[model samples]
Target: MAVASSDGEYEDDPESYHSGDSEEYQMDHRPWLERTAVKRDIQDLYTVKGLYNPSLGLYRYRVVDRLGEGTFSSVYLAYDSLHNLHNNVYWLPEETKSPVGNLCVETGHQVALKKILVTSSPERVENELSILENLRGCRNVSPLVTAFRDDDQVIIVLPFHACDDFRYFYRLMDPPKIRAYMTCLLRALKDIHARGIIHRDVKPANFLFDYESGHGVLVDFGLAERYQSPREATCQHEPATRSHLHGQRCRTDDTLTVEQAVYDARKRSRAGEGKVGFRQEDARPAVKTNRAGTRGFRAPEVLFKCPDQTVAIDVWSAGVILLSILSHKFPVFNSSDDVEALMEIAALFGRNSMQRCAMLHNRTFISNVPTLDEPPESLASLILRLNPHLYTPHQPDPTPEEALEHILAVDCALDLCAKLLHVDSTRRITAAQALRHRFLGNAEDDGPDEQLDPTEGKCGLLHRWVDGQRG
Candidate 1:
């Protein structure tokens, strides 16, 4: 974990800040002397010979403002002084030259600086860098402009988009705008998953969207991991007979559904965890590792401690995102822990569905909490109760036909949300498949999105200021 604050120095063994929202931690809660000392330390980093000195490394950055703080990292907005000169030319390699791109960055250009303590494990840092490098050319994914070390900190530079996260815009956005945002996100997921990478975190805060471009990019690869490719997963299910190895079929009894086979392969590949794998006549299921992910958005399998979990976890998180939009609630669930999260889910889905989810994970849902006899509210009923405006007409004195249209639109959205929030990971809609849902429309493409050129156009902060650069 990082020992640094957004606007000050991080305490080495500071009290846990996980009690509230990561972005909304209050500095006033600390002792006055301690707070002043940390502030001084942060200011020291901005000095001439300091970590954030305006003339360091390949680029010079003038610290602008602290953005936010997380459990282990802090973000800041900084003006890149080297890239702030509008018409200054800089030499580039022949291969890096782009005909229409600017040699110099536009004036007053800004970027988001995500800084972490260098003391963290090297593998953790390397994993993030490697993943970002692999995803460098992706259009719908957040681009890492550059990274550098300063004293005991590692700073990652990212594009500074002057827009709020998807949570803020979900309510105000119309159906078309929502469709465009979903298209960008799904395209990002598709590109990364095809490369055998799973973005374990897929909440709204990790997705930033430009209202003008209608573009959203998936960020925060901290929890990401590499996994077996689809082809590799398929090969694990092949018959092991010598004749079958030589291209001769052995038995029809070996057949398994794609989902079953994939899980079996995952269990085997991750068998190192313990004596756990696909259940046969005698062997038991694998015990999952510690919990990983946000409280509300975590999938049921994750809550049930399924070690053989797959990309379906991300799909489940995305489903929660959609549910929030439909319900007009930024956070659909705010459970204190995994157990509470499951209980909250059980409220919406009914206890029977949650029990089925537990069964799929080869676990028992034997909780002291009594199961309700009457089923909880239906998806449509819940959405209607939370956001009645969706079912009501916009005009004060509306015609009967106009109101009917509003009700139908809400129903369609509810239907899509239900499919996404399914407890069965095997039955969940994938990012690609979700794009085909009626709510998102027929166009599966995201159209033209903001792309980062490694050489000239490094960040959207520069691209947005270049004026007609994308043209």
Candidate 2:
């Protein structure tokens, strides 16, 4: 099938075009003349013209075009011939009312084929597979259709969602539309965390949204890990350091009850009929690995080298995404390194507040990093300065004087951002809590409006810093 262009023009049939034979059809194709030692291995795989005249066993994919490329893999837009056939067939009895047994409806449709080189890290591959398996058939998340291994290659198939990155939509959509997209992202995060998994990477590029439906899906779980809930973790005395993580990975949960609970939870998740059943019950410490995350979005805990990182890291990144949209800056903080990132955050909250956050996690603040001499400005004031339109009332309103209401709305959004973007990991808002925030709309009940202090935060030290600045 030919992909339709934005102007409604159809491209040539994918099956008819051969790589290298025509220069016009070449994207991922490498000419035979340019082959080298390291390039020879991938030359044949990446140079192929769809699945025509080739063997892919039970799986068959007709390549449409190259979607993207990374160090270990190349993603292509393809039509899955095998899965499409399966999608038309009913796997279970028609009498069954629940749609849980039906194979994913997206089976035979266009998919994103991520082909990873065999020589890549197996641990990274396994981590992604495990998390995808755990989150199978989940809504608001990109579903993994199927995966198969070929000689020196691994292909993972996923549903092809027609959408653009968060950056594209944020510039085009209004505030309400942006809020809806963020809500969908938060919904996805809720399910991920409930399943005891943490998506260590959450950024604009990872979130894809369809403009018509106002729907967003979280993608790329390569940096994620299976978390041991603090409630169930037995190793409370363990330090959150790289060395301690090595020791924790060696330790195992020996309790049979813990295993059974996890099994039951997973079974329910697979069924997809009831609410997410995975809950914290075991006493295993948080897993630790190499420090990995995007530069600007990395949480202070991660920046300070804390090993026992939790879902809060993702919350911080989500907050950053929101801030970007509000401030009209695609990347609100464009920093060269960790030190620069810290300085960008410090400019808003002041160095005293940042130091208190480092102390909370038992991480040392670098002595060489410079701090601002002036007191920190509140988040609300900063946002107002960057986005004056947020406080501007719409034209032709019932009452001419509605600036107070608009100001309140801006404050509400700033309050939510402050909660999620806290330097102290423990003080960060959970995905569930964020859903109930006033900014998102309080639908459940009509309660008195609570006042949120502009400089107040979850950390006592931050409060002290705020007080000291005032004094």
Candidate 3:
């Protein structure tokens, strides 16, 4: 690591050192060798310090602080010393433009340094890098600055963004603010999903939102993978179509309904159909699939271990975030395992919906929970139940006009939430569709409203919404 002087100049040679304003020079007036020895010791001290606040990529990046850490990688807040010294900004690639007309601009000197641990396989690291490179300049998506590897440790540099913690402000946010947050997130997903990438992990922590600026950046591609089509999985020779691959439904879609699926599952259980003896062991191996994501945010398909996971999983995770905002809860689903997670979903969506969801993926869902057997609770009812303050008129209550606006906003948000969190992955709203939903202020037939600003360019509507909420 290189050391800098008090004036912030890199000292490459001790011979060139000049104590222009040092009282130490007058006190000691030591010989050149003695002075050099002292300077060398100081440099050694800095080198030791660098072990903790390490520089990377041949001392181009200087660590400022540790941002976060996880099982696979650690992130550091770093200063791009090279860019800072050169007074240059990192520009997006010419071909890397947002497909949905969102803005993409140059990044500043500060960056986040993601250090992938040796525990991760080389293939996984390569895949993550590839996805980031492909997603450059996508709206609201974190673009890659650069990446390098020194031996077994790999470091990826990304533009650093300042944002509030989701837990701190979720309860305080109004419906309009939630709209801005989801708009940014869904825009990011739209861009990534367009490229056939699935962000397996989509949680609040991965999205950095600065309420003051009303801008958010979606980060972390460690668990991201390319979407594998169900058609390709079963029949490789068939050419893939956009509709068939993007949100492919299971074969049971035509035959199964929530009511019928639930009834059949219960009837089979009562008749002991497909029940196997405890001693009847088979030599078949258990089916396995990638089920990578945060505990509460994983979609039903992921929990059901569906082999044909698609980009819909990301939308489901985003829905969970929206659910959190509406219900005034940071984590609406708190489960230790997949089974518990499914039960939590069933509790809200009803076992009937869960059964239909299971059948969609060629699986059976049977639950003994009496409460879940009841009809699914409407999202509007659930939101009001969890957050009664939204509906109750209290002190400082708004006028009739204001109250109506609030109700309408909440209704649109709940409708979008329902669409995004649909039990069937194939039927869930796509990121592009979510952006155009009335909740995000882009209804297909409706003309531009006050939410849009003509001068803000193609994404003016979204930009205005964000700007309007800025503190």
Candidate 4:
């Protein structure tokens, strides 16, 4: 029997930052940057050279700020001189943080540049690069516009998408605009899955919305995969009534539901020890090697716990993303390691074994991993709750449902959430089914929301300075 353990850099419990209604917002308890020092060198490459495209006829561009950073690379906001004097944005290396910040504002185009570390194994970099390269176009997926090569590093260029991944926006919005979050991303994911691709990492941080365009564009295709290495799924027999995000008043002092409180108790129940359901079946095939993806979002099939796991994995993560957005970005489940990941999933959804999943074979799955002994009911319940103020659940008209109707709506949303989170591998919904989910599908298509693009015309950060622009 093989024993899989965490690399130790990860935390056992998720760091809860910014309880929105209060002063604490945007605290960095767990930082992805500190874990990787080599990323600094990756940024150095941008200093010597930058993205060059003959079509733009650009010579020089300047960067403004950083978008986000991770173990392998960091994306920056920059601009290309050739793009023009309007809003231009570009992605630069993190090393360029100092130089780029010092740069004079030449243009106003904002571009998202990805910097890949040289020390990273070539194979790993290739996987990330391939994921991005394959996701070009397809509306829902971020388009890879171009690429730049230095002596050692590989730089990827994507349009400057809005910074509000679902989670980040949830915190910024007052009360919250929940339904919009689900509808927009669901549409985008539908487009992506239709094109034979799976966005393995379906967290809020990976999506961006152009309020101006009123279109939520999915970004961060780093962990995406081609249609071939996909998942298999089927519709589950679930309760019809669930929560709907229509209209809800927001207040400063809101408390968790009985379900929500129970959920918290459940997670607290598992401290120090991991392994909710790290069965030997999930011990990974003897032949397969290489691990990718964040702990909480990883699918059971990826862990080899369920051999037939498919796109439903993305659906499961998407469900978590939806709940996180509704709860102001608190991850539905925080598993810093592989064993903890299984436990988190199994506890909430129940654990399953690969051998058992295979039994369904040509038939539908009617099973899952065993539930954690004495699992806290509140953990999944509270974690399952979605505030309509944020998500705005789907409804017939969404104008009126009376008080009971309102309560029914909340229950409906949580119910659908539970279905998506079903521990049984076969029971979970796929991104495609999620698009047609009762919560998201019931509402009439809001069609092309009319909001200003938070990232309008800001693709390169090289736009001409307003009058006397800063240098």
Maximum-lDDT candidate? 3
C-alpha lDDT of residue 208 in model 3:
95
lDDT of 2 by residue, 24-72 (tens): 2224454544323223223344443333223433225655456666666
Candidate 3 structure quality by residue, lDDT tens digits, 390-413: 754332768998787877887888
Better of 2 and 4 by TM-score: 2
- Mind giving the per-residue lDDT tens digits that candidate 1 earns over 100-128? 33323433355677776555676877788
Instruction: Give me the overall lDDT of model 2.
Output: 0.61
Per-model TM against the reference: 0.67, 0.67, 0.74, 0.58
Candidate number achieving the greatest TM-score relative to the actual structure: 3
Ranking by lDDT: 3, 2, 1, 4
State the lDDT at 53 in candidate 3: 23
- lDDT tens digits, residues 226-325, model 4? 4332111211111111111111112222222423443443464345244333356775445332245677777655554432334556766767765665
Candidate 4 versus truth, CA RMSD in Å, comes to 17.5
Selected candidate, larger lDDT, 1 vs 3: 3
Which regions of candidate 2 deviate over 4 angstroms? 1-59, 87-108, 229-289, 366-375, 393-408, 441-471
lDDT of 4 at 199: 68
